[model samples]
Target: MEWLERMNRAIDYIEENLTGDIELSEAARMACCSSYHFQRMFSFITNVTLSEYIRRRRLTLAALELQHSGVAKVIDVALKYGYDSPVSFARAFHALHGITPAMARQDGIALKAYPRLSFLITIRGADAMNYRIETKESFEVFGIEGIFRTDGDGEAPQTPAKLWEQSHANGDVKQLEARAGVLPSFVSQDLYPVNAVCSYRKTGPDTFPYMLCAFKEENSNTDGYTTVTIPAYTWVIFPSEPHQWEQFGDTIETLYRRFYTEWLPTAGYEQVDGVEFEMNGTKNGLNYIELWFAVRKI
Candidate 1:
């Protein structure tokens, strides 16, 4: 099935069963995909994580009912929305809407509502993406590494680029490059706790450490450099258009959106790993960009 259509079906299912128990795995099954792929694709396509979207929708419905319905107690409303206890429900509700349930009930407080979502795919950009599938054994990369947080979904923090920019500006880029052996990879976990994202940290005084790393197998001979050998795996390598120099963030976003919405489902492949990264090819007028995403056959 087309991914968008399957996503639409998933959305319908969530709306229909909003007041009942909903399983993440079951939702992916309904979409005819694996839980990992489904959740990743959902985040890529919608720019919102699956859990966040669900919570918003549930809270929206609950808040509307709280204001309009004759439900007497907030606990009843919370239970109806699948919360185990009023305290848990109240905390979540307040976090999302900026108002507690009792406060909403007492004075009929107005709250921000997360409306139901529908999937819609649109194409606007004219640039063609350059990408290919790669299969290789594990390798090592020597660079800097750090961890950062994603505020809501998988949003990129300002840290990564700032690190890169500072390195470039302070002439630390050349020093690191002298020690740079292989290109690096970005390692990430599929399921992260709420509001926390992995960050990047400098590896050494001269060399920035790469948390998620990648490199050719033959170049693992750097002095004082640790080796992180990745297992043999398949990857999707995307070459960015030459026109998007210094616009790494936007270019990557566009690529992910397309992969989630246009590729993947139709390509008959399922995502297997959270390991993703970019290869800094020789710069060409600030437009040469290539991104690599690790994947495996499903």
Candidate 2:
């Protein structure tokens, strides 16, 4: 319930500022999280990016105003909703409503509307989530890193998967795997296999750096990848049940969805400012993946 309140408060902030400049940071503050985490949580829970949600809501209101107000000018309505020019505004407006801003003034015209958002929970079947918490010493990892923007008018966050594919295609993954021990058979539990993502204090307004890498073993070779050090922190680890290799993606995604929706709100913990791991490997001829979220007791 508290989590719902924080999120709904954030929605209220967005709703109140629909006609003016809405600072995502302020909305995150109302939700008691960093801007990046808030956006991530929002996307996961709502299946919509925060920026796109805001855009839809703004356009919904602008459409209503344009349809009702006989005196409303297209340029003035466009500026009210943060578009600097009528052309850009019309482009966005038509994309959402399938009609132009000028057409919006025609009586009996149709427009799409996205109502304000509020967070709530619904009781489903007796599903279970598996997780553990561990506090470990600070560690260092080496890998290839790329900065990605969280907010845009694009598709869902596929950057992580894309990064993995790129590494595999370009021999980056092979290079690291060649020097590193194979999982389960030779790698220590401390060695996050080839799956760890890290440290933050949001690097940019809409961008965060994601790494495709592994824990730096003392004698392991680091010939090509850059190394990054992550400070000590507590992590909540969620492990999906061991399954066949073909089910890896679905299993991991379900685990992540449960982590944010079923765990974070009720578990009395919050994702902290540090590293996270997508700890994965094979054991007993079955593949498995775990999500390690750096967290603190709320």
Candidate 3:
């Protein structure tokens, strides 16, 4: 199936299972990608997490049922939508619609609704994407790792920055740099940070491991640091532009948003099962960064 069709089918699957158990695995299956890639793509394209999208959809439907169904019990409606108890349902419902279930039954109560989503291919060549496709062999990286939750908003989360600060304060970054045998040459600085997803299947809803890392030799002793192996795959690298330091985060976010939303459906490529990473560097006195995603031809 085509990428757009696969994504639309995923949305259809979610709609069909809204009143039942909706598994990320099932959605990913329909989308023809791994759960991690599907979730990441969905968030980047829709600007909301999968869990958040599901919750809003469920609450939206629940509000409609409450407002229109004259004799339906609140507990029945809640249980139908996978809420274990009325209290939990009420909390979620109020959070989304800003009105209680009982209040929704009263006349003229306005409720917000999250409509079903569909995918389309939009031709967006206004801003040329500075990216290239390359294949690389398996490599190892040694780094200091920390757990971080990616926020729903496009902004970079503060947790990774905090981890970097902690590592610097404790001298772990310097120690790692000193022990490094094969340093990352992309950056002029001695320390090169690579943020990567840990394990796709094991990652929590919002949490993944972020690593401040450098390339290491085969025999290098990684006594205190965590070592991760990046498997060989074809990667699409998005190189940063010069003089965009002030809009760095926003630019990266826009690139991602465009890549997933506008590019993927027509790119004739699909993301493979692997961790994605961001490379932070500097070149010729300008800040440089690149996003790397493992992919395969569709």
Candidate 4:
């Protein structure tokens, strides 16, 4: 996260201009990256989407100004943040703070304040990651999936525990695993929509029936599991330390953020269409784990 210093600098720039026009292109320059790349990196590193963060921060400031300052006109506040009118700002403010601007101004409503972000590089290079880039035909995956939403940073859905419990109680997951060790995948869906985290198993591409996949096509041989054909692509494989299960989501998020925000820009790789995969070697205590991703040269 050494490069996070640049992110912090960018945050400072945002804070300084919350009252003025804040452009995505300008912010990208502050971060020393292109707008698309900066926005993507910002979402990954912060674990909160950039647009969401800005909206929250803006509303928080507006609420504070209403409470503590002399800005009596809602339209004025809205215009200051680039909103077209009071109605628009109020709508956005309600979405973020769960209350309309007028109500919040009069009733002292609670608001979410997104503090400026800071990134610090930590040195822990001991953990070994096992992964390799792969090139295969485009594929499809089929399996029953459940969507889980994160409450905020580090607040993932509890569905995994439930899914595992129900699957084991019904002996469905065990049966499925017995068929083959299918790897679970974490996918970013709906382009940063609230509660957009989904977990799934590979099926097949453009096939009538989809199948749940366990491990890579090479690892297992089983009857129930289906093979999905995937297009050839480069991949990055990372290994997790022995016995670190509780922090799986946090660790994965951190690594992915660093890989995208810090590593990939200089590493000369761009994401390609392929399902991201997570391999857990030891489920009982998390002795080790691996993450697989698809990529190609920029």
Best by TM-score: 2
Give me candidate 2's TM-score against the actual structure. 0.86
Worst window of 10 by summed lDDT in candidate 1: 190-199
Deviation (Å) of 55 in candidate 2: 0.9
Q: How close is every model to the real structure, measured as TM-score?
A: 0.60, 0.86, 0.83, 0.50
Q: lDDT of all predictions, in order shown?
A: 0.61, 0.78, 0.75, 0.56
Q: Which 10-residue span in candidate 4 carries the lowest summed lDDT?
A: 188-197
> Per-residue alpha-carbon lDDT of model 1 for 1-298, expressed as tens digits?
5556777888888888889976665676667655554676788877788878888999988888887765658889889998999999999999998988867655646698777887765654675656799886665454445443322222333355555666567765565455544333442221111111111222222222234233423443445533454566687867666555557678767777776666665566655434555554434445445555666654
lDDT of 2 at 41: 83
Decide which is better by lDDT, 2 or 4: 2
1-298: candidate 4 lDDT, tens digit per residue? 3345556788888878877876766776666654544665678867787777777788888888777665578888889887998888988888887877777666556776766666665454654434455554544443334433322222332345555556557766556555443332332111111011122222222111112234333344445444444555556766555557577677767667657645555456654432355545554445455556666775
Error of 2 at 98 (Å): 2.3
Candidate No. with top lDDT: 2
State in Å the error of residue 168, model 3. 3.8
Q: Which stretches of candidate 3 lie over 4 Å from their true place?
A: 146-165, 182-210, 218-221, 243-246
lDDT of 1: 0.61
| Candidate 3 accuracy as TM-score | 0.83
